[model samples]
Target: MSKKVILITGASSGMGKETAKALIQEGHTVYTVARRIDHMQDLKNMGGYPIQMDVTNENDIQNVVDTIIKHESKIDVLWNNAGYGLYGAVEDIPVDEARKQFEVNLFGLATITQKVVPYMRQAKSGTIINTSSMGGKMYTPMGAWYHASKHAVEGFSDCLRLELQEFNIKVVVLEPGVIATEFGEVMLKNISQFSSKGAYSSLTNQLVTATKKMYDKGQGSKPTVISKTVSKIVNETKPKTRYRVGLWAKPMVWMRIYLGDKLFDKIIMSQLS
Candidate 1:
């Protein structure tokens, strides 16, 4: 296989970090970008280019794109994976905070994709792997903003795939279920303000407790599972539009499709409760 130049955002941790390492191991020139440069120091040691990037910053994103174009001449794969979950009821989470979540999860991702698309178009061969989640397809309590962002990604990726087909640009969505990561901690921290006396308090606590338990018990899939799936998608001659990996992702997608909204809601509520 020919060596490809790949750029992955959110490479400081979780699935992104694992995927960057795996891609580098597979002989790809990997450039890993995230806000936490220190977290990616090991990646740099392994020959992966570590780029300090806050996806929410338009200038920083544009700079990364320009840097890639200047050095590599072309980017074979652009992994849009920098995102976080803000878990809280829609009514409880501050509107501005919710908007901030969208800025990072939706707008930021879209901005980077826009900057990279022209290069990929010129190359006429590239893959864009977007990191979505099972919540994108199914409803989950206390994850309104996060779910909305992933749903947006689902739609955005679908549209891009259709539009870029003629240009040989493949848009793949990686939908991971609950993975053992610091994601839960970040969600908890982001929604702490909404944890007191409200209609959502009990539900929020239940959901948080369940999430903590799952993480502690190691019931969720490892980051490497998703990383391996991403590697396969990047390396495939013809990749599928969506790769739903991890334990509950497939089941959740099937349930959402087959059981309808009401039943699925009941199932999810029961699981959290």
Candidate 2:
């Protein structure tokens, strides 16, 4: 595998952090970016450069690209991984919260990718790997906003893949299933804050009960599982457009695509049992 200069966002925790480490171990130069500079210090210690960046801010996004270029001269891979899940019923979540979710998850990712594309296009080679979720292709009750944002990412990635093909810029979408991380904790907190006691209280309650147990039992795959796939995508000469990794990722997505929507809906609701 050739040594590539890579930029990864949301590197303070979870899959992003793990991927940064794996890439560096594979002899690549990696720059890790996130809002919590302190949290990324560990990543920096592992031979990765950590930059404080809030993905929702356009200036921050541009600065990250600029900083990498100033040092590395080019960006070979962009792991556009900055995002969060905002879980709540569609009617229960505030309009502002929903929009904010898109701002961070969709708009920020798109902006950063756009900023880097020019550099990639000039070089005539690059890859943008987006960390979309399995929920992008499937949905569950009380997670309307989160699912919507991921669904948008899936579509956006497809469009990007087609457009950048001519430039020899590969666009890959990562659809991860349950990975052991703070993401679940954060999502639950959001749901509790917004939908715990309203018109959708029963639905929210059931979701919380089911999801909390699953997370507590630690059923999700480790972050390293995704890191392996990331390494493969970067190393392969002819990488696929999408890599659905981690536990239950493929099964969940395939079931939804082959099975009817009603059957999938029942299976989703059965989680409450």
Candidate 3:
């Protein structure tokens, strides 16, 4: 396989970090970006280029793009993976916080894609992989904002794939189920605010408790699983438009499609309960 120049966002931890490492091991020039530069120092030590980037900052993204263009001359792959989970009840999460979630998960991702597209167009060949979630297809309680953002990613990626197909630019969506990460801790923190004494307090506490327990028990797949799937997508000559990774991703997607909405909702509710 030809060594490709790849730029991966959110590479400070979890799947992004693992993917960067795997790509580098395969001899690809991996440029990893994230807010915490220190978290990516290990990646740099491993021969992956680390760039301090916050997707919400347009200038930061532009700088990274410009740097890559200047040094690599062209980017062969773009992993739009910078995102977070802002889990809370819709009624409890402030509208501003909800918008911020979209800003980071959806708008920020789109912004980086926009900056990279012209370069890909110039090269006339490139692969764009987006990190969506299983929640993108199947909804879960207390994650309304996060799910909405991911759903937007689902739609955005689909449209982008269609639009960029004629340009020989492949757009792929990576949908992952729960993985052992700091994501659950963040979600639990958000839940505390929503679960504060109120009409929905009981349900909120139940949901938070269940989520925390699942994560604490380490019931989710490892980040390496998703990272391997990403490596295949990056290296394959012909990659699937969507690669659903992790333990529950495929089963949940199947249930969402075949079981219909009512049943799916019941299953999801039961999971939380």
Compose the digit string of candidate 3's lDDT tens values, residues 40-118: 9899899999999989999999999999999999999999998888876778779998989999999999999999999
Which residue pairs clash within candidate 1?
none
Q: Write model 1 residue lDDT over 1-273, tens digit each, in one string.
A: 778999999999999998899988898999999999999999999999999999999999999999988999999999999999988778878889889989999899999999999999998999999999988998787788899999999999999999999999999998999898789889887666676458877887788788878878889889999888988888898999898889799999999999998998899888886
Q: Which regions in candidate 1 have their CA more than 4 angstroms from the true location?
A: none
Candidate 1 residue-wise lDDT at 267: 92
Which of 1 and 2 is ahead in TM-score? 2
Residue 104, model 2: Cα distance from true site in angstroms: 0.8
Residue 210, candidate 1: Cα error in Å is 1.2
The models' CA-based lDDT, in order, is: 0.90, 0.91, 0.90
- Candidates, ranked, lDDT: 2, 3, 1
Evaluated with TM-score, which candidate comes out highest? 2
State TM-scores per candidate: 0.97, 0.98, 0.97
Q: What TM-score number comes out for model 1?
A: 0.97
Q: After superposition on all CA atoms, what RMSD does each candidate show versus the true structure?
A: 1.1, 0.9, 1.1
